[model samples]
Target chain A: MDNNGFASYFRFSNVDWNNMWSATWETVWMTLVSIIVVAILGALLGLLLFETNGSSSWGARILNWVVAAFVNIFRSIPFIILIVLLLPATQAIMGTIIGPKAALPSLIISAAPFYARLVEIAFHEIDHGVIEAAQSMGATRTQIIGKVLLPESMPALVSGITVTSISLIGYTAMAGAIGAGGLGNLAYLDGFQANNNAVTLVATVIIVLIVFICQFIGDILVKRIDKR
Target chain B: MIEFKDVSKTFNAKEGQVHAVEDVNLNIPDGKIYGIVGYSGAGKSTLIRMLNGLEFPTTGSVTINGTEISGLSGKALRNQRLKIGMIFQHFNLLWSRTVIENIEFPLEIAKVPKKQRVEKAQHLAELVGLAGRENAYPSELSGGQKQRVGIARALANDPEILLSDEATSALDPQTTDEVLDLLLSINKQLNLTVVVITHEMHVIRKICDQVAVLDAGKIVEQGPVLDVFKRPQQTITKRFVNQETGSSNLDDTTVVVSELLTKYSNGVIVKLTFHGDQAKLPIVSEMLRQFPDVDLSIIEGSIHQTQEGALGSLYIQLIAEQQDNINGALEYLKTMRVEVEVIKRG
Candidate 1:
């Protein structure tokens, strides 16, 4: 095998180091911002969904229906199409729809609903007897939620957000495809479009590394917090 | 006193209107351990739950210390519940919290100062025999130890009434007794009115001063534990008493009695039931001496001690050369306050 020919095939010349670094940062920034927002939004929605699901009041029934429908509709939408569909809202919220910041609204909207479902499942996994015990202690509804439900279900909630964060990273890559300025954009414009296999290979490897790091941190956090 | 005035709870299920508790009037005096014993689905839980407002009566009212519990709702109901501590069969301790934290939970609900709450919880932990286990999580404890934590948590608020919803049902016999003893001591120490709901007759026989036997949503019999055990009017009441005394094995007793009866063709089999001070008396030996011509042999016997007194039932065979001596022995037992039921004559 000729060494020069192998270099030409694998590591094509003139790769822009600055552009690659900026794109990597953009991917990380988008993922970080989207996940934080998703965690908050998803947790509230999940709690509402769980609390109102079997409630007898008419107001709660309608609220449950509305929240459930919203979660279902948003979660079913593919992340790629969701970015285009959320363009108008993104422009209104972030003042532009061209870069990593613009991808935030679509990324959070698409992923929060998916994460909300996980959050709801995690709350459901809590023993009903534990809830009854809290009630028998004369805990008001708010106290039960604050002092008992949330703390008891913390490990599951952390693991859930971790899973959502990993998916958020993937969504950020998808957002990068349409000029959002992430590794996906670098891979697309410089690697695929310009026929630079080396750039695409490096971007894919970095994204995989980021996912592993996210999962590793999540596992350790869950292990440390989960007494059960 | 906690009074249930014509209290009845009905649940509207898909099947039909199910009466969980029907027309029950019970008065649980302060500083006494009251037990509501019944089989599964006998409304024992519903009856006790009403005392704490966990279940509201469909028709009547529950008055505890002059407060109408049935009419309360929202914050009022929650406040009433705070004064009436309840422990569950499953322990129901927060698995996430350590023993001390679990004990401090109701204090937190009461909004006690952090320092005071910790001190009170510390005292309660040792009171319920969970002193050194304060930092241990519920998962790290054994079944008996978990129940001790539960008892500590229930007493955290220094409640006037402690509702035990089959608290000992999940424990082994030995553990159940230990927990019962702790409850009995707590009832005396704090002078707290304890309302225990359980199907276990041993629980009633162990700690309860007064017992109400519930069957199919109604109180079939209710009285002092010793009195109820001495003369159980209903079949269910008799069954519960027999369960505790191991006399429910009457089938085996009958087989043994028949075998003994055939062997001793001239013996009289008599069942002697004695309660209170009479149980302590050597009535059987005294009767044998009174009728010295008669020979007595023990067949089967059991003694059960209740909160009120001890109840003992003994099955014995009296052999004599003459039937008149057996008859004389039977009459002598009656004068000694021993209830004698002649089982068979040979």
Candidate 2:
């Protein structure tokens, strides 16, 4: 309960309690915002990929190639390199390149394709018979996607986003090392640079806890929704 | 009535051109169960799918009432599909939905009002004998129960034609009969034209009034169920008939009959086939009474009741001191509208 007393016991000579709180808030905010955007964009991209995969139509084949190329290219890039590479786009979008907001472009761009691949696999795991049954019932393309594909693959989609969220948390930390203000920024600046071991340990523990919480919630959601 | 006029479906697969259905012509009268029986890959599935516009024929047309199903596309095709409900071998009930919800799916696609959909689904659930288990998910239901749900869902739209694609193939014999009974009752009660595609002759025998025996994308033999049972023209058709008659166990029957022949040197084995109303008569008893000197012994007997009438096959051994007595008994049976095949004689 006593923040300063807790800090002193661990020989936390360089620990700033106020800065640590702000940094934790920044990390949570970046992950939260980026994951929501990623879920939407990723799911749409994945649906398009799956729907167009085996299509014989000229339009669908071309769209499938373009979307597939974008996903593959973004997914192959290392997160750290992606952030550096997207700095110009980041500067244009956020008007600055040194805070949590500046990291959004790269965070979404990097994670969306990763989650999109997951989403496509999730859709593939659905029973083809279920889709056929929907078609037999006179369901339109949109109706099939909405009523059958999406609802049937909900558990997989949620678990996918949960995984993407955890990875986005890690990406936020990586984004932090380049002057984005988060727990990673705090740990790198105040712990590693200043030779303070306690600050690094505390930040690592918080990041681990966030990942655990995300996993726990994801498990419950999947269990509740997965009737199969 | 539904008609398939020179319908053929040839799929261009990776290997080459594959003819699934080859110039098949069929006439399925309204309000009757028509079966397309075949082994796997006989193109029965492809033929049935063309009725609902699920698979368009490569040539010719499938017309239900007056509408050519193969000629329609997009919304028009889909709307036509709404009128033709289909059930699968897998049941294909949505795992994410409850029994009632699954039944309401087609109604939802048709954009029926929620209250009306719920009422109609409830009625169909009861009709298919899934009355109390409306809240159960497909995973919680047994194979038979899931198929009951499938029947309920197929009937939700009150479709004029119900396409059953091996709907009872995955079920046990007892359950297959139960689903077939439900389909038969639906056909009668709703006047729905039912097209059943299956490899099982039991399915064709039990409910189908008319049957087309498909072999390698062609209808090798087709006629009324009783007529087919009485005389199967093709080898494949004979095999399907044997499936129901228990005649496929020919080796066992031969062993039993030959053993009986060995025991009685004076015995004569006659394989008697009784068709239609003759199966229910005392024709066998009359023959024995007329030739009282002959000893009558039944080896193996089976009577299958089809929609048209009963088809019975019996193997009888007649042992008499005089060969004339056995000959007289065989002649008497043949005169009573029975097909008599003399298996062996002393």
Candidate 3:
């Protein structure tokens, strides 16, 4: 189709296809970086929750309570409010709070605890028998975590990350309202404000497509890796 | 050798303190299959767990080869554990790992090189008869096969002592026998001291050289398997022996004697325990030959083989018009080393 035919069909002459593509790229970058950061920090915190709370010891119990309280406090706050609350910290860390990089700190802070809870549930689902077996074999705590717990709970963890990633996608769109330019910014400023219904619908479809692709890949990977 | 010196484990619960084990002293010798038999909640599991240092005693010491296991910690405790391998009732193989990978796990923890780890795992897999199923996940295997993987994993470190905590309890009778046989072979081939905790006396009868009967968190009776079967001192021990031999219960013996007393007023009822050489002898023929006037009617009898020897018991009614001949027959039976207990009309 010619440029005019495309413009008439979409009902918007100032679509700025390059800007929409860049915004999509921005959303992808923010989501990916936040997921990687969340995965590492979340797994460690999840393991701490698992080990400390699992057995009956006063020291571990206290530590578990502290960590659990921290996670719960962060997880209970609304993501939109959390982004605003973390604005100073994000600006200090990134030297700006209005782009893809600036969105990461808030995204990670919001998602890590959420993902940590998921990770704890994933590790909790593993059989206690497996841990006992490793202990009987004289595995150290580190070995037990790396060799036994992590491998045994990989499928659950992967599925958790997929869920977290999808949630982060939605959060990234919210980050756009705070001047963190992405697909959400395009939808709000260009489509919603410009009275372009076509742009809004197209942006919504692209976000949905991204989440769908992530879920589909996550499902396949879980199926492939889960020996159990 | 593993020795428990006044070891007792007590756990604090909301209700009260639960004494899992109480003042237990056990000596398990090297290169022997020792069975600890008890019903559920008898602290058999706790007692075995102490041997591996999984559960520490509340008030005493557990020594393996004269090394106090309770005092060990960190690397020392881990080193102690490496010498004592254990298997579980659930056959706790990691579901994510294949059979060979599971076997190689302990070796990996010990930091064995990959080549040697694979070789050792392969050897252990074949040892446990899982030679061709190295890549099979635990979920893909049968209960017996999964247990074989457990065995292989336990043996990866070449432990001197193998603790089996109701290892075959979850399997069928046929599968139980197979796993027991595998354990027996491992005990013999490696000269591994195997401490088996089980509720089934049949397991003790099959391979255990020494047996201990645990009841209410205490060892009620313990001895060589044949001796325990032949002369069970505790009521629980007697019940377990009777269960294994399918013989009349001790209380039932009294009922049978009373019934015989009403049926035959002149006859004397006697219970005879025949063990080892005595069980093989034709004591009934000899008794008849020695006292022709006395007539013997076998009421209840059973003979079974233990790891040590054959043990048998017979409840007999001795009928005779003359009481002197019955006494003479009893004397003759005792001369032949038969344990005779006069039940009625002595």
Candidate 4:
């Protein structure tokens, strides 16, 4: 490799180091908060889906249909479209439609339904015999869900969360297009529009690094918890 | 006591309604190990699940200790189930929990304190011979060991009644015997009423005092284990008994009888089924001593033990100088209460 060619490709003189660091922090903050909130909401929705659809007598059939329809509708819409569609609600919920804080509402709304579907699949993968064993032990529905269903499917649930978190990282970048203030905004405004290739390259490399780190942690945790 | 009073279960399928269980009435007395033996699709599982209210009867009530379990729901049903513990064929110990935790699950649901739950689980692990492997997960255990955990878990609630749904069906022969022995000991020590649903007749013969043979969702015959083994009234029961005793099929036995008849022009082929003391008596030697001129050759014989006593069957060909001697020998065998059948005469 020629030294001059590599130097020109990674020219750092035009990159604003302070702005890049702040954008990286903003991306981390938005992804982290959105992931935690989605984890909770998604797990609850997933469990509701599992119990209602798993048994005919559990909860109301119409309630199951309604929740299912809502999840499906949210999941079917593209993330970019969903962000635009939720602009009015986001302003009402957060008092502004800009910056990382404002972007969180749409990010959570989009990612939660996606993760809920995965959680439902995880719970469905647990052996029916295990659930039946709990029932035969005189366990109430709540006990069965907490003691059997959740614990038994923990590994899958954790893996699903990891996938959701990585997906949220990508969504946070897209949120930057509408002034959410993250690496995507820095890349779009300072790198692409300003014709600085080095800033965009660094931002893209950091996003890839975050995804890899999430995948590694997810694989390790899955292996640790999956006793079966 | 568990009583199924005209119970029936029907499933609504796309094609039509499938009758899983039909008008079944069974009385299982207390402090006894009862076996419900049947082939696949015989509704043995459906019948047993009713005892714990896991599956309710469509038409009739299932009375356990005089409480109709069929109408129970929610907390009432759960409270009723607490008195009846069940084990499964697959030994469904929670894969996420250790053996001890699995055993403590029922106690936890009962809201027993953590300390008491641990103490009781330890005691149950020892009782089921899973003492040293308390922390081991179900994935690490072998099939028999997994089943030991299952048994310990079922007994953790101090239930008076235990239901075993083909608990040994997934185990190998040796492991099946070990599990069955553990169940037998548990039944005797705790005086727990155990209802075992199995396709294997040997499982019934090994531990059950009473045996009910089900076929096509109905109990074709049921009685004391000895009675069912010796005098199986239904064709399915007879086939199960034959399989258990290592006896030849009817066609093979008939062929043997026919061959003996052609070879010995003046011989008698008699099938003698022995029960209790009759099985131990030297009937053949005694007959030879009584009639010196008669020579008897054993064709086929098998003996097995049930909860009742030793039961056996022997097919013998008696070649005598006179037909009257064979007749006298048959009469003497009948006097001893041996079911004697003359299969062939020449």
Candidate 5:
């Protein structure tokens, strides 16, 4: 394309780019906040997955079954459906269902359980023998969790977090489906409806950059922290 | 001092309730090297793990140094564990850490200062002859070296009690001896009490000051190494002693020669022990000079030094035909109290 075509398809002015920077900041804000919320929430729920024991007790079995059913129910529905279904819940909590800030609670509620299950799998991969050895060494349960289990399973945990972060980025993009103003909404309302290919191309580049940055940082952190 | 009072450990395996250790009460005196020997699943490993509170007894108490470590909890158990160190059959050196770092782990967990931890690890690495290879990982070292690192790691806490669970079972014979020698020297230098568990009779016969033979999880027989060998009470003990002293897997030629001695050799068949049983050199020549026409012909022999003392077994054929002369020879041999076994007629 000629420079005229290129300039028409892109936001080339420095001041114009700066003017739209709030949207960019909101996208970053949505992605980061949702990830933190979801990761923490999911990790906690995942621990519940491992701690339940229906097999050994009737009450534990019943409670475990109910929790298992709940986790699976949340995990199976599509994220978009989850967001739409959470509209009432979101409005109840936030007094509005349309803004990015109001949409975050649902995004986190959706992502947390998914990430938690992943954390459970990572935690289970640690050798029972190592835990037994640590116990035999007189390490307390807390010590075993801190000194043995966490340190031992950190590589998988980091990778799990990487996967979660990348997926959460995608989920944040999906948040725009509900009029949440992230790059996805920027593409939808401005780029698609307004026939502005500039917005579409910018949003695509931004999403790709977010994924690459998440992946590279995850790689570097795993390399640095994992001894095994 | 360690005392096991009627201890029994039973595990609920999928197969069934496996009695890993039956009623076993043993008194392991302070500063003595004790051996609990049995085949795999005979409860040897479980017996030792119990002493360090790694395995709690099902039906009895284990008192160590005035404390019943049987049910010690959390911080209390850890504090107890700091007083008892353990080494495993597989070495169990943390594969990620260097030899020095691995050795320093107990100290590290115990929160010993970094400088002291390093110094102690270095000293222990030197003690086990891994001084130069301190920075090497477990994967880089030989099986023997890994075990040395394990020994050093077990000693890092300077525990009064060292529990070895088949510690030398994985190494080559030569390396096993080297590790055993290192343990012996460490035992002497540190005056540490040691309890080793193994399926190998040679391990018990080589370094145990006192030994308990566990058969089907019960202490079938136990005593000083020499006493147990010379006068075994249980049939299994008899068999194990025979395996250690009666016959070695020498060439067929030696087996054939032993058969020949038992078949054709006459007079008095005597087995002479060397400075091999448990202590000083016994003057066997002075005892033998007492016999006229004794004509000692050695048929088979072995020299092994255990922790108690040096032990030896020598099979010799004697020359005597007359019943009176045989009786006299027996009389003379008994005076010296040498172990004599009748071979064959001349």
Candidate 6:
């Protein structure tokens, strides 16, 4: 602690790097699992919402109203409140509510409808003419959905997925609120509770790196699938 | 053959109901180039669209080739649609696909085998003179080429009837004529019945064997092309024909028939409408030579090439007298099928 080397007092990266590596891996795992669930469940919910419009059908009207209320309720609750409210449910589902796995249910709940609505909007934007052309060619309803309408709307869906994946990266860091061991927990506990500025600095750098990688990969996937 | 029995279409608009096509009945003969011409909002497009089962009439029956298409629903309707090919004004070829792929789309829908479809698509491409441009996307082709691709795609199924809903309306004059000529050739070579609907009389004059003038959702006038052009019954049809005939002064271009009869008081003033190679006939010269007292002065005439042949009309003064037995001789000329417009007497 000589006055001449006092600047090293705040020099955090000078510490051991193993803690940082572990925290980085936890954030990557949480983000990957969350995005996969959102992509699948969201696509299904999105398609249901589109097909079950109320104007043409009374049966669909009641179903759409119920589904719509459910989506809005989950989507309206703040992410932090959602995680706290779901502790019992998450504990029962995962057999424990404190690890990286317990956080999965709430992460999916908060993000699924958001991404699903994005998928819905992507589908609604397709040109009506393309669908008419397909029907005119004697395409069955299933064939029109599988061949023409889906392919024409692929670019918008791909772009929606890019946005959804990047947002999930942010949601994973916030998952540390539930004792999930990601960079957020490391920064919140080992740095703030231990009064160790050095540990905080390392966690901060790793989180930034994770965000950058998520964006880079998502950009490449989006560009590849974007036909238009 | 096609027939519309009391067809009517009304769209539910905010202003109440919109009657696009009224109680319209029309009979189109098989193997004839029939045309429906009308201004926008006159329902010419909506009227022709019903022929292919595209627009269902509110209260009427449409029979094509003796099959009632009005009652057909879903797959049956589409199956009927496949037998009737349609071309659009914008040439709506799929922009993402290549020229050959667009042509093969309908064939694929029909489940034609892949190998045979490829061969048929190649033959159609050559027919449209785009043999080497098969791989070109619609964005890579010109307006005319895009329309040719549309034509190839429309005829890919080898439909018995081809419906042109303002097909040439989007092309320039030269391209319009080219596409019209191609349609005429297709009609002749395949004997495919074409129903072309447009507002341009030039289209009617150029390719139609049978012409129907539509106005306000009704068939105002319809007949053989030569008869319709020569003696249009409807005011709208007359206006349309006058546009092509350049009859800017049909009222003022009085034959001066009275003056000819008084001056050459010994002669007859006659008007003849010449059509086909009949215009090239020496009938006018022979008529004068057969009656030495008669003198001929041509007033107006122009030859029009129709789907039938070279057709034209002439307004002339035949200076002759009844005393020379010219009236009986002119009666003989009528037997030759030369249309006579007797404007004055001698």
- lDDT score of residue A216 within candidate 1: 97
Off by over 4 Å in 2: A1-9, B259-267, B319-328
> Residue A63 error for model 5, in Å?
7.9
TM-score of chain A of 1: 0.94
> Which scores greater on DockQ, model 2 or model 6?
2
C-alpha positional error of residue B296 in candidate 6 after TM-score superposition, expressed in Å: 6.9
Model 6 complex DockQ against the native? 0.27
TM-score of chain A of each: 0.94, 0.95, 0.93, 0.94, 0.88, 0.88
Of candidate 5 chain A, the 10-residue stretch with the lowest lDDT total is A11-20
Model 1 misplacement above 4 A: A1-9, A12-14
Model 1, span B38-89: residue lDDT tens: 9999998888878877788999899999999989899998888888888899
3 against 5, candidate with superior TM-score: 3
Candidate 4 local lDDT, B213-322, one digit each (tens): 99989999999999888788888999998889887466787788888888888988888999888788888788788888888988888889888889988999999888
The TM-score that candidate 1 achieves is 0.96
**Tens-digit lDDT string for candidate 5 (A111-197):** 776777787787788776556666556667667666766676677777888888888778777888568877777777776776667
Evaluated at residue B332, the lDDT of candidate 1 is 89
Supply candidate 6's per-residue lDDT for A126.
69
Give candidate 1's whole-model lDDT.
0.89
Q: What is the TM-score of chain B alone in each candidate?
A: 0.96, 0.95, 0.92, 0.96, 0.88, 0.89
Please give the range of 10 consecutive residues that has the lowest summed lDDT in model 2 chain A.
A1-10
**Tens-digit lDDT string for candidate 1 (A54-170):** 999999999999999999999899889988898998899999999999998998899899888888888898888788877887899899889887888999999999989988888
Model 1 chain B: worst 10 consecutive residues (lDDT sum): B46-55
Which candidate's DockQ is highest? 4
TM-score of each: 0.96, 0.95, 0.92, 0.96, 0.82, 0.81
Candidate 3 lDDT by residue in tens digits, B1-346: 9899998899999999999899999999999999999999999998998877788999999999989998888898888888888999999888888899999989998899999999999999999999899999999999999999999999999899999999999999999999999998998899999999999998999989999999989999999998888788999998898788877466776787788788889999888988877888888898899799998787888878777778888889999999999999999988899999887784
Candidate 5 stretches greater than 4 Å from native: A1-27, A38-70, A92-96, A190-202, B13-16, B93-145, B231-235, B238-297, B319-331
lDDT of 6 by residue, B1-346 (tens): 8999999999999999999999888999888899999999999988877876668899999999888988888888889878888888877666557889889988988889999999999999999889999998787898889889888988888988988889888899999989988898989999999999998989999999999888988888889988888779989998898887776565554646555556677655566777777877887777666667756776666777776666677767665444556675677668767888776665
